[model samples]
Target: MKFRYLVAFVSLFHAFSSWASDSFIVKDIRVEGIQRTEAGTVFSYLPVKVGDTLDEEKATEAIKALYATGFFKDVKLKSENGVLIVEVDERPAIAQISINGAKEFEKDKLLEGLKQAGISESRIFSRSLLDRAEQELKRQYISRGKYAVKITTTTTPLERNRVAINFDINEGRTARIKKVSFVGNEKFKDSELRGILVLRKPDLLSWFTKNDQYSKQKLSADLETLRSYYLDRGYLEFNIESTQVSITPDLRDIYITINITEGAQYTVSDIKVAGEPLLPEEEIRKLILLKSGQVFARQKLTESVKLITDRLGDDGYAFANVNAAPELDHENRQAAFTFFIDPGRRVYIRRINITGNDRTRDEVIRREFRQMEGAWHSTKNINISKQRVDRLFFFNSVNVETPAVPNKTDQVDVNVKVEERPTGSIMFGAGYSDRQGIILNGSISQNNIFGTGNFFSLDVNTGAINKTYAASFTNPYFTVNGVSLGFDVYKRDLDTRPLSRVGTFKTETVGAGVRLGIPIAENDIVSLGLAAENTVLGVFADSPQRNKDFVTEFGKSTNNFPLTLSWARDRRDSAIWTTSGTTHRLFGEVSVPGGDLDYYKISYHQKWFYPITDNLTLMLNGEFGYGDGYTGRSLPFFKNFFAGGNNSVRGYDLNSLGPRDDRNLSLGGSKRIVGNIEVLFPVPFMKDDRSLRLSAFLDGGTVFARNIDFNLMRYSAGIALTWVSPMGPLKVSIAEPLNDQPVDRLQAFQFMFGQQF
Candidate 1:
């Protein structure tokens, strides 16, 4: 009430002043109430001057302009006896700014952004600037999963001219998903909701993908989707009663609770059409799956809407909207729903324009797009193309818009914009294993070769068994067709005795290979390859006397090399980091002069990812591989199959799988398989390009001499932690065998670093 009265009093004062100050001032002008603003500055803005007429309108104009500068709390202009008075209350200026409770971000950087927005040291500060700074800072934090935070700004008057500003930030706590529970859901178990919810608790294998990090916004969106699920079925009155998030004492862990009132589920008891039914009611009703007596289901209703839209589309009614309105019978707990569809008009695509990819070639996008120029645009095709672009892994974001074409009625043009990301990398790394000890790896790889989005790679390493030199290149687009060509040359040394990790080495392989890849569809691919190899496997001096008898039996000066054929299909989001995918590879070799040469190997791997929170996740990776017709004799000795090390099983020594070696040491070969379950969490300390992640894993696998005989194959399990660092990824594991083996040098425990693969 006082504020209202002040407004009225100010208005009356202005009216009276305007009427009274109409007289003229014909003498020297004088300035009063001067402070931070110079007297000359006021005189420069005033329209009326000495010896000139002074009017109320001119004074009012001067006062308004000063206030518009946004540097004053109050402004007044008075003229008495030819003396002018211009007084103003100056806003406090910022003397300095300090920040606290920040760990991931630097104070200087945040201050710099604030300064750019006109809130800086030695400058006046306002609540507006503080609010804006808070939002900007939060956006920066939210992009990296710091969703919950608080910012408080304090201002203290300083001597002479400014106020000290402090942005006291209570970053609160990082929200990590601890548990997600669903109540009153008897039809589907909590496990089902866990699969549906995008958020999940962090797992030991979280390094591969971030599945943890709770975001209220994201959770709210998911809940809406769940509600839609219920409404679509026949529960017209379904509602989410409430959602609660409880934090632990430390505030680091959070539990999510969702309460839902499912209400009474209604089945479609009857179907009918009213008012302007273009098609037969029975025909349209037949398209819906809500049988007259079936139980209500939100999933089915949603699908029914889709069916109606697609049915309308077949009749060239692309701009049609089909909505299902369900009229419930509360007495019977049933619903008779109606699809109130409104088909406005039929429209066609006019043109398709692509933008935002200044660095990438336009043809690259055009090739992947299913919708063409001057063609009927299918909604399904548009979404599929979006998925295709997202799967490229070379773009940060891709946006597609279909703007109505001007000067062309009933037609639209599609515009696509792409933001490119760095697609090539060169990594130099070193890894250690119980078998290899420490190994040096130098590699240069390019997924988008020369900005064309092809692939080329060269890798060199000096490690146990895998000591090799390799070079390869690939072209995803060959002559504008979805064809790829790849070639590689490599030299590797293989040693069968794993116990003597420092083995009596074998000098065997000198080889080359070629591959060709062709795309079958947007979601499918096929690859075929051929390779020729020459190897002379050698058994070293430090071996059991059985080796001498074996050599005499084979009577080998050397064995002729074999030719290999390989085929594979990889339908995964990313080869290095796949959230969901299926990868299959089959490689075989046939020897020419090496006694009925034949060897075949098959490997299959899958990964399912769930993001429990922005910073934590659960990752389950399952893998299985087997080698058939692998006599180890049909191929060159050096070409024999083997497995071990960090990427294989940690508890056992590398390649110590199949039969015993020359010195009675286990050498892994033949049928082999493994599995991994891991949880990932963000690192405690580290600000990085991609927030560093840590994880723990439990992996198990085994090997067999021939066909899988579970009893003969050994099983091992272990716990390993991995760190995805800016510099590189680091991993360490401690493993043990299911069945104890005294001679097993690595069975007690194992530790390794670098990549799991």
Candidate 2:
């Protein structure tokens, strides 16, 4: 106790001496710690320089200003050697920022999102800034259901006042949906209504449907779906009143309820077309699908409006407007619908609009456009332009906008804005199959080649059993007259499936083709083309008949006309792997291989896509291909038809679906036909980026030696896995005999890779 009091007495004496004997008066000023900062800045912050009196008020303000610049960590004011001195610690400059454990985002993309948190590539680094960055990182993960994530920063000093920064991150498990409940609708069962909602409950096969995760955003969208479901069946006033969400005690689950109000049902009593017609009234009337005496369906009525407008647009009235409105007789419960149209005067496109092209040049889009200035506008030209844009993988979404000019009558400027998406990249792959054993393949090509928006490709594959090399090119805007040109050169050596003792199947071909394109309508394009080619079929191939007939089938193509009519049926698959439903795509074609003149050929293919859940989808495909001489002559060897393999039956080798001669080389399956089905889901262990997927499938189909009887072909079914990687979608499947064909193993599978289409 005595020592403490003695020490306190000494501290009190010193404190009193310091407070009493303060130094003040005129003094000089000195500044230090100034890198990339001006001395004048430091002097401005000081209330008085060397010749002014030193005081506490001036020192306090000076310190605050110096700190506000965010360039200094420590600021001080003192008198030394009869001069007032200012000292500071400058912030460390940023040398580099490295982020580890990032898969969902690219490095540059991650940096862009981090700028809001006071972190940047070219700025300084601070502990406070790091704390903010950690919070941002946490938020990004939480948004994706990764709530158990951790982020840490490491700062290492470097030369020249700069520091290297590294952020180590651990992204933990993604929260999954436990169950889902829907309430407040008695007309439809819970199961029926849930099917309409894109968000789904977890199932054992949820890996395929990805229906395990619940998102409020998806739920809100489901509510809209519910409303549309009712409205389509005459529930004109159907409404979703509100939605409520509740969280579980564990904070791992969420329950949602949607309250709805279903209005009265009604039948259509009248149909009125209240729009100007650019064509015959009867012609426009024929386009209407809605009729009296039928129930008012929201979808059908909406389609009617679109059809009417599109028909008008085909006639140079590109700005035609059509709207469907329902009038209800409350007492009678009858609804009358009117399609209002304003076929504003026929106008030509003055200039085409192109946007969202960061890497692609303006000429790229302009080159593919079918419509030009000083030409009459037509919806056919507009749609053709859209197809050209769609072929550019550089865009995630493309949209057309036509805003009316208030004073300008009969003319509209077309705006074609696209949401640019990354298209060019490299891919490397390796996979094993029963037939091919182990296959390795890769390719590098630009979909938007040379930024001209023209399609050009040079792809090669050399596997244990398969070798292929191909070069192809396509011009969307081949000429000002609306012609499109395509040409290809290729060679292949394929090992037929079932591993028959027959030697390897080989093909060599070179060709150049031209098509005369003519617009028929908004959704129709007709083309005619001719080609010259030289070909030879190798011996001991899948079928020996190929050599028997091929010597007479090589030479000139007559005309390839109406050769490309693509009909696609699709159900959007939010996830491609582990899929459950089907989307159907059908294409019809007529072409010529090599005949003197006007040779005709035809083909058709149908694909179905069905989704079982958010994570799973089922795809069924059918194709009918054929070619013959128009004047009853021999068809060109290369232009003749054949089908097999992963894209067709999944159990056969590439182009190995026809008859074989005594030596076992394929002649061909001129009237080729095939069908198949597949089920896809997500892969476990791989990060759930959605861009990556895994799947299993069963495919059964066969080529017809004769006409497509639809019943003569064999069937094969089995399973496989897939990965929709960033570079491409890789598919691997195993197939087995379903029809008991004389085989121990229909006993094989195939691998496929597709990037764009």
* Top-lDDT structure, candidate number: 1
The sequence of per-residue lDDT tens digits that candidate 1 reaches over residues 201-221 is: 887644444457777677878
lDDT of 2 by residue, 174-199 (tens): 66665556566667787888778876
Q: Which 10 successive residues of model 2 have the least lDDT summed?
A: 554-563
Off by over 4 Å in 2: 1-184, 190-219, 237-259, 271-293, 299-328, 337-348, 353-364, 374-383, 392-412, 415-479, 482-648, 651-712, 719-730, 743-745, 752-757
Give, for candidate 1, the lowest lDDT window spanning 10 residues: 633-642
Cα displacement (Å) at residue 498, model 1: 6.0
lDDT (C-alpha, whole model) for all candidates: 0.66, 0.64
